[model samples]
Target chain A: MVSLILSTAVRYIFPLQLLFSIFLLLRGHNEPGGGFVGGLVVAAAFSLVALANNVWTAQRTMGVNPRVLIGVGLLAAAVSGLQALIAGQPFMTAAWIARDIPVLGKVGTPLLFDFGVYLVVIGVTLTIIFTLMEE
Target chain B: MMQVNTVMNIWIVLPILIPLLTAVGAVLAWNWRRVQRVLSVIGSAALLGAGLKLLLTVWTDGILALQIGSWPAPFGITLAADLFSAIMVVLAGLLAVTVTLYSLASMDMERESFGYYPILHILLMGVCGAFLSGDIFNLYVWFEVLLIASFVLLTLGGERAQLEGAIKYVTLNLMASALFLAGVGVLYGIAGTLNMADLAVQLAKMEHPEIVTAVSMLFLIAFGIKAAVFPLFFWLPASYHTPPVAVSAIFSGLLTKVGVYALFRVFTLLFVHNIRYTHTMILIIAGFTMVTGVLGAVAQTEFRRLLSFHIVSQIGYLLMGLGLYHPAAMAAAVFFMVHVVLAKSTLFLVSGVVHWLQGTYDLKKLGGLYASAPGLALLFLIPALSLAGIPPLPGFFAKLALVGAGLQLGQYVISAVALAVSILTLFSMIKIWNEAFWKPQPLAATCASAQPVLLIIPIVLLALVILGIGFFAGPLFTLAARAAEQLSDPAGYIQAVLGGA
Candidate 1:
């Protein structure tokens, strides 16, 4: 019932894909990668985990319910836009940190918005995939 | 200078943003069905308040335009609300609140646990976004968002009938979306702009007027299907009655009207270059849509199916206002839209209550409503009479506004058709009354007891609003007139959005 080679390979591939997805999410504002792409990567990673072993293993790997991710992602995106309104600007007007903050240099609302998108993409894709696979 | 105005425009975004946030909140509370319910209700109330503030701001401060990300005009995503869009957004909020309330009593927990409230709020977000979007492409994006939510809502329980309806519904809507996108792409290719105000400006200066006219036809076909105009309306009656009646109420109330609103917006704003041809074509379509829809209703014995057919006919009336292309006619169209949303949704809710009680939607299997539940009968009468254009009801005034405009414009043939359709509409309403309420009980066991007070509250409140609009038609008419003025002459709209471009 188990494929040793594939499951072992997935252990390495899954974490690598997740790390790369985070990199894409962080670098999205200045580079080719963004939340949507990164989210897809993460989703792909989980799907690979499911394929290599079974959906139950992948479900356990994704610790939280996928719906929670969707909600959090949407809230983050909406709240990022509201920051502009709170700062006496029109809603969704990009506001940025003037100084560099640790490893993330010059954070902005767009990146936050993109992060939300990443989560939503991951949440939605995983939920659909997991539900269908489980069925 | 523009920076100062952006701050004032913050409220303009709330109508869209509130729903988005509400959708998120509802989703987050997915594990707790009660929390999702509370979130939808409170969020919709906030939406209503925000819509009213936005309407007041637009009324006093003129049009408010917001450029997302602080991008400059003609280049950024623009959300502009004139009086018309403001009114629509407010009405949408009202629909949201009432439907959410209705869902409290009507929706089963099985559906609730499936993220119904979240999906509903997401649908509202799409609606508000579509209304506020000043960019045509942005409107398409919002349409997709709402359509996806609707697809989920339509088949949430996966009933066999729902799957059948959903298949036809999604297939047709997807076709319409493709057509609309193709039209938008061509329009962008021609004008090199997606901002509606900018498109209007650029369209005026284009060398090829004929190309613009052809592009206008593309918009007409695209919106025509979505509007469920004649020859493309089979999908509506096929799918609308399949969903939970709360879902049906919102769909019947708002969905097709979006198509109508878009047609009115684009035609009056951008496609005025070929009024003689396009308007005439719209007028002809309006006439057929009315006749065919009413004729279809006369044949349906089931309750919701008849109402579904009436929705198609009513679209014809709204389109007639558009086809007439007069300021008064456009104002009438706006007024008519508000009336239909309230009255039609109330009717659907009433149907929901009846179905909940009687366990069937078939008219033949229903009787003794007047005998068993006279109060429900009376509540139903308010909207039904209003729908039939009876005196002292909003429907009467709505029809008067449209017919008056039609006759004033000297379009006698369409005017005659409009009058004929109203009488036919009355005939069908009377038919329903005779069959469902007035007739004696055909079976004693099938008689429905009194409905829950909570369900009746929405019906009564909506009826009261219909009555309120009827009695206080003066201010509302004035507002509709102002909105029509902006549509016919977009100088105010273009000035506000483009800032002297």
Candidate 2:
């Protein structure tokens, strides 16, 4: 089973997978990656953890329930869309910024929207995986 | 401070922002049920206030627009609230408040593992955002927001029936999303701008009539699936009856109306010039949709299923008014949509109470509920009769407006069909009354006990709203008429989106 493989590999690879997911989420707005893809990657990582350690352990390790993740994701996505309203623009109007920070420079609403998408992807993906595993 | 001109721009964003903030607040308050309840109530109330405030401002001042991130109009996303969008936001907010109250009493906390209040708030946020978005692509994003929330709500309990229904609901909606995306792609390719107001301007200047017609047809098909218009309506009745009563009530009240709202927006603003072909097709479809939907209702013995089918039947009237395209007719369509939301949601909730008492929504098995639950029966009667278009109720006036508009246009055949459908609607409602309320009690003493007051209060309040709209038809009708006028004349909308002429 996939769980067997995940269990063996999770002890060695979870942190790297988590880092990969964050990278995907952060780079999504400009590149081919974004919230949805990032969320999926994160969910896949969690699934690997679940497969290795058992669903409960995986759930506990994530530190938040999948359903809560979904709620948070929905809230995040909605907030990201509403950012347009703050600027006197319409809903879900993608707004961005180019900044020169010490290391990172740009931030925008699309990235936020992508983050929302990431949460939704992780929430939905885990909801399915966990529910199926429970069954 | 010199009176700045930009204060009004904030009003445009208020619609989406209030609900979004409230959703977050609701989630954060989830650990404290009392705080969650207070947050949800106040949040929705605030949204309602914001919506009304925007409506009044628009009524006095005309249209308002906001440019996100200081970007110029054509390139940046625009959030504009004209008469039409403002009214929808207010209505959506009001319904949301009532549904939240209803859910507070009805939802099972154990089964609702995720934060139920938060999801409901976000769903409202999505609905409001969709109504307020000025661009086509943004509308797609809002639709997905609402659709995903609804999918979760639909299958919340994971009952066998709920899961089955959710599968059909999700799959069908995904297909509709694909169709919507395709339509947007074609439209963007042809017109070169996804902004609705900009598209309207460009589309007006384009010469190829055939291409315009094809694009309009694509929009019709895409929105039709969402609105549950005749050919695309089968998925609605199948899935709608499966969700819990409160979830079903909110879904029935708000979701399809958003679709209807979108169709009206796109057709009136963007595709108005192609009236002959599109209008004629709409008229034909509207007529069939009314008759067939009612026939489906008549065939149903279950309370929820019957109401689900009736939702389809009533949508026909809304579309008919739009198809007529007269200002009065469009106003009637707006009025009809408001009436249906109030009436249908009341009926669905009453059915919930019936199920709580008799353990069934089957009409044959649900006799003498009137004796046991007189308050519920009365709550049921108002919307039921209103839905059947009985005089002095909102539904009656809504139907009257549509019928009058049909007659004014000399669309006699369609008018006649509308009359026939109204009569059949009455018949089906009476059938529900006869089987569910008037017949002798089918159950023992325990089943005859009073229903939960918490649940009944929301239903009664909604019924009151129905009556209030009916009695004070002047102001609301005027509001609807103003929205219709704005819809008919896209000048203000275009100007607002293209950054204030």
Candidate 3:
């Protein structure tokens, strides 16, 4: 049976974990935090739900197929490289919008690439975890 | 003028770009299996066209290098194609198109829906990436990409046999990757550069040449495992026959060759300081690899398993050329690579058909394609005889080149071994012909008269490609000669990549 105290604590912890993961993703371009660590944090939060609740509820909370996430992440990374190819330069040349965007600083392809990495990390890790747990 | 540069540069990387987008296209269209099939085939066709263009560009313009992200040489990742790499890309594209088409008709519905096509394209992308990568670290990354994809493809069906095969395949290959990465790490520490060209320059000038020689063994073992050479080859025959026919066919055609390619690339580019020890060691390994592989083939009763053993044997001939370490020997290796890919894949595809028709690959349970299906027998014989190196076939000419080079260099023992190996190879091939084709009908009336159009098309296409190589031996030899010449002189490659640095 699910422990009431653990379930209640996870409910409060999950939202904060997601917020921290996002913070990691945002800071990834320059600082130590990036998509990989950020994704792991989110995956850990979801796993806690599976421990305190159940896998079905965790899947419901995520509300997206892991395979689809992989596809989208790969698409984002490849397209970021392709945009440079289209712009008559070598592939993956970082191009910036030339303006600082609020808290995210100047936006560019590298940041997009980091976000793609974030998505793939989450997709692959959860795919492994879910498959093993189910087994 | 700038537009012209962009257009030319675009051709150099299209082999990789097309497949990456193709995989992404297949993945994103996950909900629609029909769309995925059409997309995969079309993507493969496009890759074939791009491969041809890339080959043509490399033919006329010479070695082309792209500094990705416009980073300077020895710093940024680079994608480059010389004549040899371009040819391999073309071969990869050709195999991709054939296998993708074959899978459309033969792949199970479960594997189809579970992301098969996407993963297949990703494997192609990794193969092309490995062929085109100019940086050593980038090469390792591409190897992992392809290896990971191969692992997933091998286990797609989740059959007990597939799972068993995949576990061995995964463990051995992961060890190879660890060795490869460790080699990379140590090389970087010594040479302080990840660019292959830059490393060649620095490695050549090192004060203690013996340390570099010691380090070369790491690559030999690492690549030897991938190439399935000598002691490192058991993983291949153990796991290769376990996959679906389409998967086996492509793996037979291209996967081990990637390992061989890395061996050729690394030895010629960076580790030429002491040819006496290193290349000679390869020569010894090549000889044993040939003997063991053919002997294993002689003992196999199953069709696919026999073919897997032969892949290892065929690699021996390629290595014989490398072991000889002359320009003509290298040229011979290049020619043999192209010839064997077509021949081996054709044989595998024919075996797929045999299994499909009779519902078994066991020779004891099989017989009489000769009586019921003369055309299929002919298809099988063309590649079988070619593989056995009969006259006027691609295999004969390829063998002649290697043996001739071996004799020319006075490496008489290896040349003699090469000849003896071919005889054994012929004996094993004949065993298959007798058991599977020439023997009397085992099932009698159950032998169907017709084969599926989809299955026959690829086997016939590849066999005809084998025949084509036999017919146009002169031009193929010329291209291989040019590639070998480029490999013979690392200075041109180093200059082209480093560009006045």
TM-score of each: 0.98, 0.89, 0.98
Task: Give Cα distance to truth, residue B343, candidate 2, Å.
Answer: 1.0
Residue B459 error, candidate 2, Å: 1.6
lDDT of 2 by residue, B204-255 (tens): 9988968988988888888898899988988899999998898889899989
Better of 1 and 3 by TM-score: 1
TM-score for predicted model 2 compared with the true structure: 0.89
Give the poorly placed runs of model 2, Cα more than 4 Å off. A1-100, A105-135, B1-6, B26-35, B443-448
Give one digit per residue, the lDDT tens place, for model 3 in B1-501. 233555577877788889888888898898899999999999999999999999999899888888787887889998888899999999999999999888987899999999999999999999999999999999999999999999999999999988998888898899999999999999999999999999999999999998898889999999999999999998999899998999999999999999999999999999999999999999999999999999999999999999999999999989988988999999999999999988898899899899887778999789987776788889998888888899899899999999999999999999999999999999999999999888986765465556789988988788888888999999999999999999989888887788855
Instruction: Between candidates 1 and 2, name the one with more favorable TM-score.
Output: 1
Per-model i-RMS: 1.1, 4.3, 1.3
Clashing pairs for predicted structure model 2, backbone only: A7-A52, A28-A33, A28-A34, A35-A118, A88-B66, A88-B67, A89-B66, A89-B79, A90-B78, A90-B79
Model 3 misplaced stretches (Cα beyond 4 Å)? B1-6, B445-448
- List each candidate's DockQ score: 0.83, 0.27, 0.71
The C-alpha lDDT values of all candidates are 0.90, 0.84, 0.90
Indicate the DockQ of the complex predicted as candidate 1. 0.83
Docking class of 2: acceptable
Please name the candidate that would achieve the greatest TM-score relative to the true structure. Answer: 1
lDDT at B272, model 3: 96
